[model samples]
Target: MPELPEVETTLRGIKPHVAGQCLRGAVVRVQKLRWPVPPNLSELVAGQTVDDITRRGKYLLLHLTGQTLMLHLGMSGSLRIVPDEIPVGKHDHVDLLLDGKRLRLTDPRKFGAVLLLDHDPYASPLLAGLGVEPLSAELTGDGLRSRARGRFVAIKNFIMDQKVVVGVGNIYASEALFRSGINPLRACNSLDSKEWNRLVGDIRHVLTEAIAAGGTTLQDFTGSDGRPGYFRQELRVYGREGEPCSRCGAAIVQEKIGQRSSFFCPDCQK
Candidate 1:
């Protein structure tokens, strides 16, 4: 699935073209997605000017004059900015026809979503329960420490919780924990102030680096321009199981925790 960086990259890539452009029309080639594309979605956005584009967690928000269009690029979804004359591919589920450009949504697995938000999208159910954005000022070491006070869940799982902190996906989580020298299986409540400080910094560092690299392309993720992310080339421990640890020369290991693969250097992390 496209995580925060991928979604943010998409928002940045498409914003220049879509923002301030009036929508000529909306083409819903297929209405059924992870959630049904709003029945009147086409009418709602037609002729409306796109004011801006932003991302919250993994969802992209297209801010229009009176409403916002919420998009979730599920496990196999991607948005591309293509010429209006370009032909749609097999998985091109929707398209927003701008004055001279086109924004197309391609979801091979149909797990993505296109919804209309008449009111404040942030307060909507889809976004209401999400936790602090890792990039925001509210996500400090003290904040993370307070949230983990009495939780017995694995520290990895604790940070991955959307209600605790948004956008810390499996790959980024592993990288952050590795950078912080925290074992992924450590109980959340066991982290002291020192560890929490390191963890907070590592999480921010990992995510900021990933966004700068245009996100990690391990699978279907790509920027809005259809470019594969280069961050995977800079990975330290996420997918280097059994390889030498970059920091300590120890062997990196992999394990399944909470049904997600976790990579760490035993000697370097605890």
Candidate 2:
């Protein structure tokens, strides 16, 4: 699945090309995605100029004058800008046709989504329920501490909770925990205000760096331009299980927390 960084990267990559461009048409090659691609999506988006492209959590919002299209790149989906003459592949499920160029959404696993929203996207159930964005001013040490007041869940799982703070996925969560020197198995309530501050900073630092590097290099994830994220090369503990820790030189370890494999430096992150 594409996490926040990848989603943000995609938004940044396509915004310039798609923003202000009029939608000539939309071709829904596959109507069934994670949610059914709105059958009349073409009619809704046709001739509308893209007002902006923004991200809330992992979802992308293509804002138009009066309509909004929300997209989720579930497990294996991506959007790319291509010339009109380019041939669409089997996985190329949808096309947003511009005057001479188009934005193509290819989702091999069919887990992605394309939905049309009549009103404000931020007020919709999808975006409205999300927690404060990790990069936003609302996410702070005090904010995290308040949310974590009585939780017994592992700090890893606690921070991973979207209700606590959005967009800290498996990869970045582990990396941020390692960077913050917090053991994944430690109880959330065990962390003090100072540690919460460190953790918050680490999450922001890691996420910003990942977005700059284009996100973790996963098997199926790539940026809009087919660029694999180089941040994976700098991972500290996410996938370095059983390998030497970068800081303390102790072997990094992995364990299941909240059903996701979490890696950390048992020595350094203690």
Candidate 3:
């Protein structure tokens, strides 16, 4: 699944080609998507001008004349900007025809979605109740500490909670915890102010660096330009299980937490 960094990279990559372009039309090659591509999307988006392209968490929002199109690139989904004359492939589900270029959505598992709405987009259920953006000013050490107070769940699971903070997925949570030198199994409520401060700073640092590297390509994830991310080269522990730990020369091990694999150096992250 694509995370915050991948979505942010997509927003940046496609903005140059799609911004300010007139929407000549829309084509729903297959209406059956994760949520059934809105039946009236094609008619509603025709002849409108694109206002801007932005990202919230993992969803991409296309600001149009009177409505906003919310797109979620679910597991194994990708959006590419291709020439109009290019032929669509087997899994290509939708296309937005611009004056010059086109935007195409490809999803192998059909878990991605394209939605159209005419009301205030933030109020939509899909966007509502989402936790604070991890990259925003609201996600501070004190803020996270307050939320974790009296909570006995694992710190990794706590930060991965969408209601607590959005976009801290499995890979990022593992990497962030490793960077902060915190064991992934630590109870949330046991953390002190000092630990919270380090965790918060490291989370921001890891995520910012991942976005700058165009996101880590673990499985099916790739940038809108179809290029693999470079961040994987700098990862300290996420995928280096059973390898020598760079800091302490101890073996990095893996465990299943919340059904996600967590790689960490037992000696370094105590």
Clashes of each: 0, 0, 0
Residues 1-270, model 1: lDDT tens digits: 577777888888889988899988788889989989877677878989989888888888989999999998887888989988998788999999887778999999999999989889999998999989999898988898888887899999999998999988888899999999999999999999999989989999988998899988987778888898889988899889989999999999999999999999999797
lDDT of 1: 0.89
TM-score attained by model 3: 0.95
lDDT of 2 by residue, 120-213 (tens): 7889898887888999999999988888888799998888888788888888889999999999999998999999999999999999999999
Global lDDT for candidate 2? 0.89
Q: What is the lDDT of residue 211 in candidate 3?
A: 95
**Is 1 or 3 the stronger prediction by TM-score?**
1
Residue 106 alpha-carbon offset, candidate 1, angstroms: 1.4
Error of 1 at 19 (Å): 0.8
Instruction: State each model's CA lDDT, in order.
Output: 0.89, 0.89, 0.87
RMSD of 3: 1.4
Model 3 C-alpha lDDT per residue in residues 1-270, reported as the tens digit of each score: 677888888888889888898898888988898888877677789989889988888889999988999999887788889888988899889999987678999888898899987788989988897888989998988888999888999999999988888888888898899889999999998888999999989889999999999988877677879897878888888878888988889999999988888888899886
